[model samples]
Target: MYNALMGTAATTAVGAGLTLYYLEKNSAHANMEAEGLHPADYPFPQKKLFGTFDHASIRRGFQVFKEVCSACHSLDLVHWRNLVDVAYTEDEVREMAEEFEYTDGPDDKGEMFERPGKLTDPIPRPYANEEAARAANAGALPPDLSLITKARHGGVDYIYALLTGYCDPPAGVEVREGLNYNPYFPGGAIAMAQNIFDGVVEYEDGTPNTASQIAKDVVTFLNWAAEPELDDRKKIGAKALLLFSSLTLMALWIKRNRWHTLKSRKIAFNSPKNWNKKPNPPSKN
Candidate 1:
C-alpha cells in the first residue's frame, strides 16, 4: 500500500514539473500578444523622469529613507562608498558614511579609528544579518534595496509607483485583512503600510511638503543608488559602440579580400582556356 501511494505521488510530481516547464518556456511568447500595462493604469502616478538620476529627487529620497523606511528596511547591499556617485562630493559622502556604524575594527594603536567609509562600503544593516531580519518580519524577509530598482518589474517605474500608490479605503477594491491597498503594487495590495505623508520629513532644500513630491524624490534616490555609474556607463557604451563599428568595417574588408582570393582561385581552375572538355550537366532522378 505504501509503495502504491509513493508511485502515485511520483507520477503527480512528474506531471506537475512537466506542466511548469512548458508554461515557463512559453510564457514570454504568451505575453508577447497580451497588452502590456503601465504603472499609470493603476492608482499610482508614474514618474516624469526615468532611466536617469535626478539629483534633487535623490536628495529628497535620502531624507525619506532616513526618516521612515530606514527604521525597518535596511540597505545592506549599498555601501557608504557608493553614495559618491549620486552627485555627492567626496566630503559629503564621507560625512554620510560616518552616520552609519559598521562591524569592522582597527589595529593595535588602542585608539578606535573611526572607519571612514570608502566609495565601495556595502550599506550596513540595522539587523545583524538576514537571519535577524527574517526573525523580525515573521519569516517574511524584506528585500535589499541596492539592486531592487533593477530586480523589480517595470524596474524604476514599479518602485515609483509602489511608493506613491499607497492609500486607505480604496474604492471598488476589497483588501485582505492584514494587507493594505497599494495600487502601484503588482497585485494592488501589500503588507507594508502607506509610509509617506506631507511634511513627514522637513526638507532644508525648500522642496514642498507633499506626498507625491516626497515619493518621487525617494524613488529618484533609489534609482541612483541602484546605478551610481549610469552617466559614465552611457558614455562608455557610446565609445564602445563607435570602436566596434570601426573594427567591424575592418573585418568586412578582410573578409572581402579572403572571398576575392577564393573566387580568383576557382576562376583560374575552371577557366575555359585551362579546361579542354565540356562539363556534363544532364542527370536522371
Candidate 2:
C-alpha cells in the first residue's frame, strides 16, 4: 500500500510539473511573438565526419578575435601552442606569444614579475578578475569565447545571427541606455554594442573583411576552439566505420562460401513400407 501511494504521488507531481512547464513555454512563445521577435537563422557551414576544417577561415577568425573580441572577452581555455601548425607557424606563434606581457615568478627575490608569454601559457585576460571585467563593462560580464559556440542554444548559427543582428529597435520600442537592439538576443536588447563592421579588421590574406564575413569567421574560430579535436574525432570515426564495414563484408562472404554446399545439396526421402516391400519382391525374384 505504501509503495502504491508513493508511486501515485510521484505520478501526480510529475504531471503537475509538466503542465506548468507547458504553460510557461507557451506564455514565453506568445510574449516573443508579441514583441516581434523570432528565431534568427544563419547558414552555418556544416562539419562532416570525413571533412577537415577550413584552416584559412579559422586563421582569419583568430585574427578577428585577437584584434576586436579580445579587448573585452577572455579566451583563457586556449593556449598559444594550440595555434601552432593550425593557425600559425612555430616562429609566428612564438612571436605572437612574445607580444603579450605575462607575469612570471621571481628567481631570488621571491617576487612575481612580468615577462613575455610562452607557448604553454593560457590566453591573456582583458582584466585582472571578474570584478574588474564587470566594472569595465557596466556590470555585464563578457562570456569566454572559447566555448561560446557550444554553450549557446543554436551553436554557430545563433552566434552568427547575434553578431550580425544589431540594428535600430522597432517602432514603439524604446531601448535603454547602454543597451543595443538585436533580434537574435532573447529580450531584443543586448549589452554588447555592434562589434562587427565592414573593414573592422584588415584580413591578412586579402579577403574582403565585410561585417558578415567577420561574424562568420569569428564564429567558426569559436566553434573550432570549443571542439579542437573535431578533426581527429572525425578522422577516427571514419576509419573505424571503414574498418567495420570491410570486416562485415568479409564475414558475409565467408559465411556464404561455407554454407554454399549444404544450401545447394539435394536430398531424397522414401517410405518405410516401400523398403519393406522391396525385400519381399527380391525374395520372390
Candidate 3:
C-alpha cells in the first residue's frame, strides 16, 4: 500500500507539472503571436554549405555603403586594403583610400598633422565621439557596421528585414512620433527610420538601384565585412574534407585486406612427441 500510494502520488505530480509546462509554453507562444512578427527567412545564396559570395553584388554593396550608409553608420573594422581583390582592384582601392584624409602623428615641430588615408587605415567614423553621434540622432548612437551581421540576433536576414520592413502600424497599435514601425524589431518600433529607398545609390556596374537590390547588396557587404576570411575558410574546409575522405577510403581498403588475413589465419598446436620421437628412440638405443 505504501509503495502503491507513493507511485500514484508521483504520477499525479508529474502529470500536473507537465500540464503547467504546456500551459505556460502555449501562453508564451500566443503572446508572441500578438506582439510582432519574426524576421523573414531570406534566401541568401552565400549562406549555403558550399556556396560562395557574389563578388559583383559585394562590389555594388560597397558602392551603396559609401554613398548611403556612410553618412550615419561606420565601418571601423574594415580597412581599405581589404577591398583589394574582393571588391576593388589595388589601384582603385588606393585612390579610394586617398579620398579620405587621416590624422597623422605629431611632426618634428611637436604638432599633429593631417595626411591622405592609406590602405592600412581603418574606415573612418562619421562622428568624432559617441556623444556627438547620439546628439545628432536624438540620443540614438548608430552601431558600427563592421560586425553588424554577426552581432544581431538573426544576422543578415534580420538587418535586411529591418531595412525593408517599415510599414504602417497595425490597428490598435500606437507608435511614438520619433520611432518608426518595423515589425522585425523588438516591440515593433525602432529609433532609426527607414533609410533605404529606391535610387538611394547608383551602381557603377550598372546594376539596378532598386531598394531591395540596394539592401541586398549592402547586407552582403556587411556580411563579408563581418567574416572576411569566409572564402578562404570555405576553400580550406573543402580541401581538407577531400584529402581526409581519400585517406579514409585508402585506410578502409588497407584495413580490410590486412585484417582479413589476420582474422582468417589458422592456429594449431603440434604434438611435441611427433618431432622428438626419433631422438628419444636414438637416446634409448
Candidate 4:
C-alpha cells in the first residue's frame, strides 16, 4: 500500500513539473517574439569594482535634464549649491540659479512675489504642483528623478534603455493610442516618449552627442544625483580599511614577539635510570 502511494505521488510530481516546464518555455518564446522589447546591453560603468561617475558625462546629462527632462520630472532633493565642483563651477551655478525666479517673500504687504533664485534654492519645477504637472502631461504624473537610478531595477541600465528603447509595436501586439511601446519597460508599454536624439545638446568638451551618448550621460548624472556622497563614502571606507589592516598586522607582530620565549623554550626530562645513579650520595654517607 505504501509503495503504491509513493508511485502515485511521483507521477503527480512529474506531471506538475512537465506542465511548469512547458509554460515557462512558451512564455520565453512569446517574450522573444514580442516587438519593441529586447534585453538592454549592460552599461560599462556598472562592471567595475570601484565604478566612479564620468563627471563629463554627468555634466552633459545635467544639461539634458535641465533643458528637456525638467519639463516633466522634478529633482526635488537636489540643491543649486550641491552642483558646486561636481557638475558646475560655483560661478556657473550662481549664474544658472539667477536665470530662474522663485517666490521668496510675503513681507510688509503680506503678498508673495518672485525673486531671482539663490545658491541655496532648489531646482525650479515646471509645474506649480502635482495636479498641475499631471494635468499638463495628460494625467500621467512624471516621477521625481532624485533617486530614480537607485529606485529602478536595473539602475543606470534601465534608465538608459528606457530613454533609447522607444519603437513601433509588434504586429500582433496592440498599443493603446497614448502609450508607446518599449520592450525594456515591464509592461512593454511606456507613457514617456523617446526624448534623446543625435545633436540634442552640443557638448562643450567636443564629445559627439549621439543618442546613446546622451542617454548614457543623463543616466550618469541621475546616478550621481541619487548618491552624491558616493566618492566620499568610498574614500572614507578605503581609509578605514587601510588603518584597520595596518593595526591588525601590528597586533599580529606584537603577539608573535610576546610569545617568542614560550614558543622557543625547550625542556629536558631525566630518566628513572639517571635518578637511580645515587653513587656519589652513598659514598659521602
Over the stretch 216-243, how does candidate 1's per-residue lDDT look in tens digits? 7777777777777776777687789999
Order of quality (TM-score): 3, 2, 4, 1
**Alpha-carbon lDDT of model 2:** 0.86
Candidate 4 Cα deviation (angstroms), residue 210: 0.1
Cα lDDT listed for each candidate: 0.70, 0.86, 0.88, 0.84
Best prediction by TM-score? 3
User: Candidate 2 residues 177-218, lDDT tens each?
Assistant: 999888778878889999899999999799999999999899
- Between the candidate structures 3 and 4, which one is better when assessed by TM-score? 3
Question: What TM-score would each prediction reach against the true structure?
Answer: 0.60, 0.80, 0.84, 0.78
Q: Which model scores highest in lDDT? A: 3
Model 3, 200-274: lDDT tens digits are 887787888999999999999999999999888999999999999999999999899879989889999987767
Error of 3 at 156 (Å): 1.2
Determine which window of 10 residues in candidate 4 has minimal summed lDDT. 32-41
How many residue pairs clash (N, CA or C atoms closer than 3 angstroms) in each of the candidate models, in the order given?
Answer: 7, 0, 0, 1
Clashing pairs in 2: none
Model 3 global lDDT (CA atoms, 0 to 1): 0.88
lDDT-superior candidate, 2 or 4: 2
